[model samples]
Target chain A: MFSKILVANRGEIAVRIMRACRELGVATVAVYSEADRGALHVQVADEAVFIGPAPALESYLNMERLVEAAHHTGAEAIHPGYGFLAENPEFVRLCEEAGLVFIGPDSKAMALVGDKIRARQVVEEVGVPIIPGMKKSFPNLEDYRQAAQEIGYPVMIKASAGGGGKGMRIVYQEEDLLPALEAGQREAKAAFGDEAVYLEKYLEEPRHVEFQVLADHEGNIVHLFERECSIQRRHQKIVEETPSLALDDDLRFRMGEAAKKVMQAVGYTNAGTVEFLLDKDKNFYFLEVNARLQVEHPVTELTTGIDLVHQQIRIAAGQRLSFSQEEINQRGHALECRIYAEDPAKNFLPSSGRIIYLREPVGPGIRHDGGVYAGFEVPIYYDPILAKLITWGETRDQACARMKKALEDYVILGIKTTIPFLREVVQHPAFLEGKISTHFIPRYFSEWRPRPPSPEGQRLALIGAALREMKQGRERKRPTQLMSAGQDFLSPWQTLGPWRLGRRS
Target chain B: MNFEFMVDQKRIPVAIEKTSQGWEIDLGEAKVVVDAHWISENCVSLILEGKSYTLHVVPVDNGYLCYVQGELWSLGRPTQDLEYSQADQAGAVGDKLKVKAPMPGKVIKINVQEGEAVRENQTLAVVEAMKMENEIKAAQAGRVKKILVSVGELVDADRPLIELEEE
Candidate 1:
């Protein structure tokens, strides 16, 4: 095993990778931008290196700086924890050139799968089902229109190198196709520096499910069950759960086999995820392959008792697979709610401020992978995700109930968050019954408002607030000017009962 | 002590008087006892009708922002008549529109120059925050009078980005 590994990312996932390395008795190095001098990931690592300025283009996404940081720290391997350069095939090649092992699949497999169009072709060649769409990117408007017509209307224009909903659009008619194609190309060039995009047949009311696949360097591969991630807003997943209600035992087995076959076909190694879109009739089609550890990997980890990061490290060190597919069983159910620093009421606009108060939930079957402390200032230059609240139980209902209770116990103040909105989602009857699609947020909660407090609760809050001011004012006053009994309405001697003041307040 | 409490934009006038037993709060016909004890700097324990409630309070400019039972209330001693002003709530009025940022972020691009005519929904500036670029658009057709911020400047939420003169 490598004595030291460098984490080339920031936020919760960086900290997560370092934690796994530390447990394996390996020292870890953290690379940070100027804006992340006091970031949690830097504080947790054994060594830290300043990469560049605040912008991701100059820091996290700069492959030269990342390799230099690893070389400077003498890190034997580099773990690009999701986002940034995690799935960049060029970054993997650079790591290889610098004599450092990239803790993911080789660059050959990544190049084959990173391009969405090429991925569709490869999966289809291996007898895996893919959505009926263009085999390659369109060159011009006429070509795109022809492909859209062949695939029928209501097709999707997606960037070949895009994720997280950027550089993508859904066109419902020919009139919308030109504007969407132009917009898609512009966004793709801005986001990925590539103007290549392809068409995909849009499936209405399809549930987003994905299978986790882990492969070792010695041609051994296994597949974990599936996670239902249909709860989304603006094409980004907000909530995820394992052992989807839409998949029965038979369907789950088939998806698992299909995932393993795809990975095996690509000579894939380390941990990766194969996403699928499950339609209303229980038929599933391959969506794309995420060639790195996912943000929602914890949901799969908790269910199968598999430490994916540790496995990734082992595979990079040329280790054989420790467990077979039959041994990996999905036990119990796990749900994950991504707690972001955004206001759901304001079109999910991201908000940034210092965290004044934070109370993480704690109990059996509960885990909170948080990245910020009470006094940490959430920066405006990165993702808005602050933490992930995960819960587990013997049954899906039990897990849902635990997740709802855990959300109530979680508290974060001084900035807007999606906690209240997430609580509403988990408690909704449709969600509990597993009748959800990617349009869950828009169809059911487009104009949802927070549940108002009871009238009695409001009255009590005002009274308490008024008294709080009075108490603070009196404490700041001079001792000699302290009010006597019956002098003012805010006199402590009059407001405090004798019996209650004796005990702890 | 007399104060006005703002809850969801509705202001309620409350009056309190010291009594032999506890503080009596008068809100029109309803009277309640509020026995408050200071627990810490930002926390207070209050008892009303034998039920205890713990409240978190943060002192703001001229008022107290308190949280109780997952509800937020702002209590302030009305400086004067406490009339609600829509000007503070909305950014602009009449023909002119004040383009403001939806959230705190750094300005990355200024698309329009001062004195340039812009149509409704035309991109005026791009502010990048939370790793996403949001374009600030013109709400109404007008000529830009002043650009309040430059590129790479950090701005707070609702801070004016550009001021438009009625065209």
Candidate 2:
């Protein structure tokens, strides 16, 4: 194993990776941008390096700075946790050129999967089922119509350089194809300056399910299981769980095998996720590849009892597979809820501020991977994820119930969060019954509002507020864990409250 | 001590008196017995009539934000004791739409220029915070007078981005 590894990310994921390194007895280095100088990941690492300014382009995404930081810190390798430059092929190649092992797939494999069109062609050649679509964009309108008929109706015309849903249209029948194609091309020309458009079958009500795969240097590959992440807002997943309700044993095995096959074909190494869109008819189509440790990996870890970070490190250190595919088994069930610093009530707008108070939930069958502490000023320059609350149980219902109770126990004051909204999701009858799809959020919760507090609830809250109002003077700063661990006496922190917004009058 | 608060437009008047057992609280018509203790700076543990509940409350600006279960309730306002609110004061700045930011962030882009006519709901500027771009939109169709803040300028919550004269 490498003696020291540099974590090339921040937030909960960077902290999570360093924790795994500590367990393996490997010293870890953390790189931070200006906004994250006092971040949890920076404070916890064995060594820290300042990269650049708050803007990601000036820091985290700066490939040259990342490589230099690894070298200056004497880190043997760099672990791009997730986001930023994790899937950037140029960064992967830079690490390789600088002789610092990148704890993920090599640049060749990354480049192959990074290009959507090429990856689709490559995976299809390896017999992995792909979404039926045109391999390349066409300028002619008649060609799109012919391809749509072959691929069948309900086809989507998307710009080759599409983003932000621009230059995209879905047609259910032949009549809508020509006009839609012309509009898509015109929009594409005005938006991306690329009039070329591609055609593909659009699957309605498809669930976003993905498989976690691990590969060693010797080409040995195995899949842990599947995570159904259908609960998403604005194309970003918020809730994820393993052992998808939509998949039977036979279907699970097939999807798992297909995931491994895709990885094996590319000669990919380390931990990566192969995403699939499982449709209503039980058929699955390839979505894309996430070439790093996923945010929802804890669900896979809980079910399979495998440490993915440790495996990634070992694989980068040129180790062979320690176990076979048969040894891996999906245990009961595990669920993960991403606790982001965003308001769900106001169209899920991002909310940022100092964490005036924070209390993490704790108990058996519950694990919280948090990235911030009380008083940590959540910077306005990064991802809003503050933590992930994962729960395990012998059954899905048990996990669901545990998640609900744990969410109530979780307390993060000041900034708004998705806690109230998530609690409603886990308890929604349709979600509990496993009837969900990618449209789950829009279908069930577009007009959702936070339930009104009960009369008693309001009374207690107002009374609590009144007590603070009566407390003569106010303490301005945050309340801290001033008491040392295992202290017998009650410190002032336990008996006195400090942080208050101030009296209204 | 007597305190007044508002929740969703309803007025709540609470009176409290400290006692040896705990504190007795009077909610207008009814009186409730309670034992309350501060567990942390913003967390209070209260046992009301033999039932236990931990209420998380944080003092923010001129108001108190309280959390019960997953739901949040914000009490009071900047004009807590005043009968009229900022909403009523809006007429004072009438005929000019001051496009204010909803939160503190750096303005990454200005979508409109001075004297440009913009439709209602059209994006006026984009403020990037917490790695998300929040589009500041025009509430009514209007012509921009002048941009108040430059691109790349960091702004506080409610800082007006631009003033729009009615079009």
Instruction: Choose the strongest candidate by lDDT.
Output: 1
Worst 10-residue lDDT window, candidate 2 chain A? A484-493
Q: What is the TM-score of chain B alone in each candidate?
A: 0.77, 0.77
| lDDT per residue as tens, model 1, B53-150 | 77766665556666666655566545521444354445345424888899999897899999999999998998877866677889889999999999
True contacts kept of each: 0.55, 0.56
Candidate 2 docks at the CAPRI level of acceptable
lDDT of each residue in A66-136, candidate 1, tens digit only = 99999999999999988778888999999999999999999999887788888888899989899999999
Runs off by more than 4 Å, candidate 1: A138-142, A189-195, A470-505, B1-54, B60-64, B74-96, B106-126, B141-155, B165-167
How does each model score on TM-score?
A: 0.87, 0.86
Chain A TM-score compared with the true chain A, each model in order? 0.91, 0.85
Clashes of 2: 4
Q: How many residue pairs clash per model?
A: 0, 4
Top TM-score prediction, candidate number: 1
Pairs with steric clashes in candidate 1: none
